[model samples]
Target: MSSTQLFRVSGISLLLGALISLIAVLLSFFVNPSFTAPPATFQSPLWSTHYSLFFTALALTLIGLPALYVRQRGQRGDRLGFFGLLFIALGTFLALGMAGYFISVLPMVAAKAPQILKATLTETSFSIFPLGGTLFATIGTILLGIVVLRAKVFPSLVGILLLAWAVLNLLGFALQSGLLAMLVALLSTLASAVAYGWVGMILVQQAGVSGEAAYQPQTALR
Candidate 1:
C-alpha cells in the first residue's frame, strides 16, 4: 500500500528468492558431481529442484530488485540508480526467458526424443543472449553497488559486498577453464546469495521501522 510496505514486501520476496536459489545451487552440487552436466542429468529428481528454483529466483528478482530500486531512488532523480534498475530488469527478463525454456521445454524434448538432446542443449545454452544475461546482471549489480555507496541509502557494506561479488564472478568467468576458477566461482556464487540476503535484511529492517513513523524517503537510512 505504502512505499514502506512495498519495500518490505520486496525485501521479503528477495530473501525467499535468495533462499530458494541457494538451495537449488546446493542441490545441483549433489546431483551430478559436475558443474556443467549433460542433458541426462536433467532426468534426476534434482532437476525439478534446480529448474523450478532457478526460475522462481529470476522471477522474484525481476519483481523485487526493481521495487528495492524504487524505494532507494524515489523522486531524487538519480540517473545512475535508474540505469542500474533498467539493466537489472533487462537482464532478469532475459534470464527468465532462458530459465523458462530450459525448465519447461528442454526437459520435455529430452524426454520425448533423447536423440536430439545434444543439439537442443547446445542451442539452448544458459548463456544464450549475445552479451549474456548473467553479464548484464553482474554489470547492473556493480552499478547499483556504486549508486548505493554514493547515495548511502543502505549500509555501504552492502555495496562493497555487491562489488566484490561482481568482481569475483568476472574473474571466475575469465578463468573458468582452470581448476582455481572453480573455487573462485563457488565463492562468487555464495557471495551472490549473501549480498542479496544482506540487502533483504536491510529492507526488512527499514520496513519494520516504517510502521512506527510515517514513511519518509530519507528515513530509510536511519
Candidate 2:
C-alpha cells in the first residue's frame, strides 16, 4: 500500500485505541478494586473487561508507533525515534504480559487460591511489572516527545502534551495511593490519549496529501 494509505490505517488504529483507552480510564473507578479490596474483586466481570480494553489499547498503540516513527525518521534520518519505539515496545510487551496474566490467571486465583492474590503475588511480579512498565513507558514517551519536537513533522503541541503526560505519570508513581495519585493517573492517561488522537486525526486528514508533503516540516500540522 501507499505511504498515505499506511498513515490512514495507522491513524485509525491510534484513534480507536485512544478512544477505547479513555473509556477504560473512566471505567476504572467503578470497575477496578482499591489497593485494599479483597481478592475476590478479580472475579468481577468488569475487571476483566477493563484490562481487556487496556490490552487492546496497548496493542494498537504499538502498531501505530511505527507510523509515527516513520514520519520522523523519513524527515530527519534520526535514530532517536527508533529508540523511542524500542522502549515503547518493551513497555507495551511487559504491560500486555501483565494484562494477559490478570485476564487469564486471576479469575482462577480468585476462585481457587484467593490468598495468592492477597499475599505473595502482589509483593512480587505484580509489583515489578507495573514499576517496569511505568519506567519504560515514561522514558519511551519522553524520547518520542523529544523526537517529535526536534523533527518538527507533527504539531509542537503533540510533543508538549506527550511530555506533560510522561511527567505526570512519573509523578504518580511517586505518590502513595490517594486522591492525588488517582487524579494524576486520570489526567496523564487523558493527555496521552488526546495526544495520540490528535495525531491520528491529522494523519487521516493528510492521507490524500502528496507524499512530498511528508518531507516538509510541520506540513501535517498545517
Candidate 3:
C-alpha cells in the first residue's frame, strides 16, 4: 500500500522476470534450430518448448518494465532512462510477435506446406520484426547503460557489461552469420537479465530504507 511496499513488489517482480528470462535463454541453447536446418527442424518438440519459454520470458519482461521505469524515473539521467524504456517496450512487443510465429505458424507450415520452407528461410527479411527489435533493444540497452553510469544507481560494471554486450551484438549482426548472431544475442540477453536483477536488488534495498524511514515517523506520531 505504501511507496516502500510498491517498490518491494516491483523489485521482486523484476527479479523473478529476470530469472524466467535466463531460463528461456538456457532453453534456446538446447532447442533452437540451425538456420540451415531442414524444414524438419520445426517438428521437434524441443523447438516448440523453446519458443514457449521465450513467450513466457517476453510476458514477464513486459510486466517488469513499468516497475523498472518507475524506479529509474526522476533519478539522474531520467530522460535517457525514459527513452530506454520506450525502446525496450517496442522491442519486447516485436519479439513477442516473432515468438508466437515460431511457436505456432512455423511448425504448422513445416508440417503441411513443406514446399514453402526454402522460400520462407530465404526471405529472412520478410520478417523484419526480430531484426528491428534487436536494433531497438541494442540501442536502448546502450543508452540505459550510459544512464546507469551517470546515475550511479546500479554498479558501474553493470553499465559497462551492457555496453559491451550491445557492441558484441552489433558485431554479430554486421558479420551476417545467423548462427553467430543468435549466439551473441543469447549471451547479451542473459547479461541483460543479470543487470535487471541487479537493479531489482537495488530497488529492494531502497524499499527497506524507505520502510524504516516511514516506520520511524509513524512511531513518533504514536
Predicted model with the maximum lDDT:
2
User: Best candidate per TM-score, number?
Assistant: 2
> How would you order the candidates by TM-score, starting with the best?
2, 3, 1
Question: In model 2, where do residues sit more than 4 Å from their true spots?
Answer: 33-36, 210-222
Tens digit of lDDT per residue, candidate 1, span 115-176?
Answer: 87776655556446424766887888888888878877777787788888789877876764
Predicted candidate 3 versus true structure: per-residue lDDT over 37-136, tens digit per residue: 5678788898888778778877776666666667667889999988987887887788788778888888898999999877885676745777887798
Cα lDDT for residue 20, candidate 3: 76
Candidate 1, RMSD to the unseen true structure: 5.0
- Candidate 3 local lDDT, residue 130: 70
- Kindly report which residue stretches of model 3 are placed more than 4 angstroms away from their true locations once superposed: 33-36, 121-126, 172-186, 219-222
Error of 1 at 49 (Å): 1.1
Query: For candidate 2, lDDT tens digit of each residue in 112-190?
Result: 9876767756666577677788889889999999988989989989999999999998898788356777678789889
Model 3 residue 141 lDDT? Answer: 78
Give the Å shift of residue 53 in candidate 3: 1.6
RMSD value for candidate 2: 5.3
- Cα displacement (Å) at residue 46, model 3: 1.2
TM per candidate comes to 0.81, 0.87, 0.83
Q: For each candidate, what is the lDDT?
A: 0.71, 0.81, 0.76
